[model samples]
Target: MLMGEFWGLGVRFRVSAMENCWDFLQWLGPDASTCVFASLDDPSDLVRASAVSRSWRRFVIANGFSRSLCRRICPEVSNFTRAVEVSSSAMNQEVGSSTAVEWESLVREHRIYSYLCRCLVSPEGSSDCIDRCIGASSTDNFPDESIENTLEPSDRVYMRPSYWSSGGEADPQVPESLIYRLGSDLCVVNEIKIQPFKAFFQHGDPIYSVKFVRFRMGNSKLPLRSENYVTDENEGQAAADDNFVWTYISPEFPMLQESVLQSFKLPRPVLCIGGVVKIELLGRVQKQAMDGLYYICVSHVQVLGRPLSPKLALDTSEASGASVLKYFPVDSSSVAPNGASRDDEAREPSRWHAFAATLRHLRAGGAWNQAILNTLLRPVQFAEEDDDSDEEEPYA
Candidate 1:
């Protein structure tokens, strides 16, 4: 009987010890637990960890673990501090909800900061192409060097020229504007880079650049599919007068008169709500050779930002529109269009030929002429030959 009682007591003690071991907080001190959580580089990992137990969630929230990690990764997100404070204040004012609100605010801040951190570390992809150009009053678009070509990554020297006079001169006061549509209505932009185009073929090879550039973010009310799209006809109109409003405006920054790619970073990350970005090549233009007229020319332009998750809310009432823009990846061909057939690239040439032959035979009925059939039977090629020639020499 004595032995049995002793055994039972030992069993109970072991069970209690096991329970104590399971209490992760008590096992790992607060400082050690924080260090462990901070070691997780990915936000997704932290989220999974939070799910393991309630204590972990509380620890994460109280320490602002995700926010600290985000700041460590991208220090530019300092602008988020005031936003967090405002949210906390607003939450505290509600009756019987102070604790709940604090927890909720911490969770929200963790999600946002983690997202920004992910974007900062993610690989730079293709440039988010601009949907249209707005207020480019006097564009000198050559057939070979159209304004659209400014986004291309070819060896060809693509440039957008604005001529104010017949002698290939431009006005210093007038600013050329380009509007780019982002993939998401709400995105975080980080940096923007612009390369000024130099007319090297012409005498004196003047570089067309502005003294400074400015940027704005807002939504456009214009219909996307309308045939009567707005253009330079309303060039002189201010942005407020037009359908687009400037929700956020960047400070005017001076531009260099060289052909190198110059970068301009935002004061902080901007949450652009409307998906539209307006770039204003501001200030007086650089001088021209013979006419002495000023002109602003851009060889290439890139906007970089992290695309927002589809699950995130689109509410912008309390968000700031002061984000960054980054350049797209250099290899544009790798980016597949939405809804495109992925299998087209996977098939071998022989398999494609077989498929084409089968298709031709099925359509060999009456009215299908041999010439037309032959044309249809030919395999379509989508690959573009890579060009390795240097497009432009860097300015001395």
Candidate 2:
């Protein structure tokens, strides 16, 4: 059966089968070959397959199998409305060739998605993913028992009470929340751990905990600085729910009334694109003796996940809350979208040499991390520069 034709911006691809052919792609045609490649669940398999031959590499990338596989593993990637090449126009002008620029962009996408796939499959690291505390919905005291106190793992720092308390509310159904910026702009959250406060100084040493807890993850509409804050704004106005565009909201789980570290794992790993997590404490469990109001108090909080950064970063400058995934590959000169270089003749070869090195390692059954990924993607460094350093580079 003949598969329908593929319509690309500048290139048209036709899919038709042949009666007899020794080559795999020739006999199966583009459509069948694409399905076979898409069946591969492992990112490493796709990388090794790309090394089989030039035709195979072109088919794999042109079809965008890596990106599809990534989305299959985590559905949340769909929120990235679209991808923007960091510097496309500069590279396009430097290439000065539409044909080469179109193909080169495909290769760049392959490299990016390949690296991202490997990163996503990695196990959650031991370090906590919380980078800084944004704010709390309510704070009973001005600064002493502020939201900042929850950053410390321990309930007390020296002689201070290290816990955040919500302003006592007469209604027990009132909900409180804590907002925090994760360590990276992108993360895969598997679970969250929270510790309730134990009022040791007070008589009877009562524990203040919430009856239920829920989590929200997304990007802030306003830009957030890295500095940890303890805003003195009124309880409800500071960390208002309207300030963020949440992408994931976990089901409400019952919070233990004990003063121990409690863990609540999600149904599945959630992809936090904007890297902001809000913890909502619902139904206060403890009532203050001095007053008839109830409140929730938390001593420490932690979000456990894998941070995809130091190689990749999220650009949230857009007003729509959607992000642009930016690439920061090590070999900037060689990995340009259109194979940029001062020496026009060497431009195309430089990109291929980087891929060849990667193939060599893959052939040896080597497992690559981000460091190895960048190393293999880097072309050999030239000690000397071309005489026309200011001139543009293009694939000839």
Candidate 3:
């Protein structure tokens, strides 16, 4: 819902602007169904009304029209029941007649059941869950296909013959696992003998896979998945370890790479399935690895900005190079080189600059999050202990 984006950004709060959007929706009210269905392909994920609110979320869930949306739109496992249940119960309770109540209850039950199916059957973070959930009928969407069941990591490990040479007597370096972009941002890490499952948030956003590098100037290497990858039966340790790696390349900016951070960008207007969760506030903050990179679980979006459409297309020709899987023009100015509009391009600089600037601002605002910047120039801190231990104290 680009209109909603306009609304979300507070652009439409003006009296005239609000009136115009309302009138436009009314004019296209009869055609809204067409628009909503057509929106499945909308480049800007923010434009889809389903991505807009709980009210809209309820509408799609009840109608059962956007079966492809279940995976992406369904709430996170933590919030699924809360977002859907509250809405469904309220909708059912509001039905005035007994027959209508029964029908609504049936619809609610189906929606709940479908959501549960999504939780069990869909791959964690993959939009395929949405497809399965939406397509499931009462007869078909069983508990076996619930979202919980699908989170099984063993099932996630894909086993297939891969030709990359990994380990050796000394350096076990396999040519990198081929990364396949499932969507603009969604991708699956094709690690052979393990599951080939990777999921970026919402539909079609940038997904990143950092192969756990375990080497320095001289050392043996370790793949994240050793044949004997050990953890509890529940795999909590492994799951916890599989956080999004937050890296702080510059040593001086260590604090900038806190365990958590946040910034906002309107993603491409795709149908939103799940409610967003604020996971940054859940635990005690801690330091990560030396490079300020630590695994973090955070929500990221692959928005379909106008520029990314042409810029992010897959070119098999470029597969062998240091390819940009997808690029989000964070600032308006960056778009000018590509020749977009001045207004759109103007926002590009600020947009992208936000990603880098977000950390600094959040720190200033006392928000509990961090940001990463490409290393240009950074200060390195010297250890105080080294200075105190020096034999020649003054200038050693």
Candidate 4:
């Protein structure tokens, strides 16, 4: 029988199933291939789309699915074994209204599922379940440039160490003075450990408090955390409990005020986790009074923890400068040579290579930490400059 005839025989997608499928297609519309391309912006959600059925999965693979999408989607799919049953009635170029709805629903469901999976599976959230899904590959050798490009920047950003701190006592194991540069001043941000349930600090679980302070240049002000915080009441919850103990440090009055040298306060400092904390640096600022370089300062920070508050909550801050800096596009020049391929044409160093090098050092020993730290502080000064310098290259 012709494809249309099959549907006329009452062999239609289940009503509920049809609805779900159409919802997905609405998000993608007629050309699923381009919709899939749009999904590349979010690797994790794209993966969820791949798990719906054989047709969808095949489409993802054929389109060169991103590694992060592969990682984020495969595990979250409800049943990898189930074959997606296409509706014969909808096979004709002209799809029925009901069938169209079903197709859109199917794609929507896939995207949502993929996003939820990433939120729960990321290391900053639930690490255990995700670890089992992608085993030894977690620690496998760093892939070459081509493979590295397959991984998304969102996945690679977590591979580096940004900040560390912890507290259950007067002073935590982490340093008392955190040195972060802002403009011309090398601001020495002070760290004071405050525990939940303590008399002066007692208010809420996941202790949340807010302090407002003036943004004086010479003044060393430590802002108060918000009045709302996390507490023991939120410990075992599946999602973040704002009531659970969390902290915030601000240098502005309303607690949400923007300042020149701002920093975030975390519920606990993470040291044993052994990964870098990455920050999104926006080079634009709103206040005209601030200096040109003021945008380089830390805008906000969050601490990602599981159960209660697994990820750091960041406050929005306007960066300094009138014009925002454009992101440097990844090009052939950014591809660095591998250990065995060092003799190849000089390639520009990739951010991924720097990230991989840091992971490598972490696997080695303590000295590696210092090495990675120095590299992060001054990536431009690395000796590997000669080996991967893309400056003279015509393509660069």
Best by lDDT: 2
What's the TM for model 2?
A: 0.71
Worst 10 residues of 4 by lDDT: 128-137
Off by over 4 Å in 3: 1-24, 41-62, 65-68, 71-99, 106-396
TM-score for all predictions? 0.48, 0.71, 0.21, 0.20
Reference-based lDDT, each prediction: 0.52, 0.69, 0.25, 0.26
* lDDT of candidate 4 over 211-273, digit per residue (tens): 322211111122112111111111111112221121122232323223222333432222111
How would you encode candidate 1's per-residue C-alpha lDDT over 337-371 as one tens digit per residue?
32121211222232342344334334433346776
lDDT of 2 by residue, 1-396 (tens): 211112121012222222232456776677777776777777777776676556767888888888898888777777776554444343553374887777777777767777777777866474578855678887888556667556667786544567889899999999999998776778889899999999999878889999999999987777664223333222333367788888889999999999998999998778888778999999988898889789788998889888765356677766765677766553334444342212121212223422443343343344546566556544443342323222211110
Give per-residue lDDT, candidate 4, residue 380: 36
Clashes of each: 15, 0, 52, 65
Off by over 4 Å in 1: 1-52, 56-131, 134-146, 153-174, 221-242, 245-248, 265-271, 289-292, 309-396
Clashing pairs in 2: none
Q: How far does residue 4 in candidate 4 sit from its true spot (Å)?
A: 25
Count of clashes in candidate 1: 15
lDDT of 3 by residue, 254-340 (tens): 112211222222121222111001011111122123233222221121211121222222111233322112222223234334322
Deviation from native of the Cα of residue 342 in model 1, angstroms: 20
Q: Please give the lDDT score for candidate 3.
A: 0.25
Worst 10 residues of 1 by lDDT: 338-347
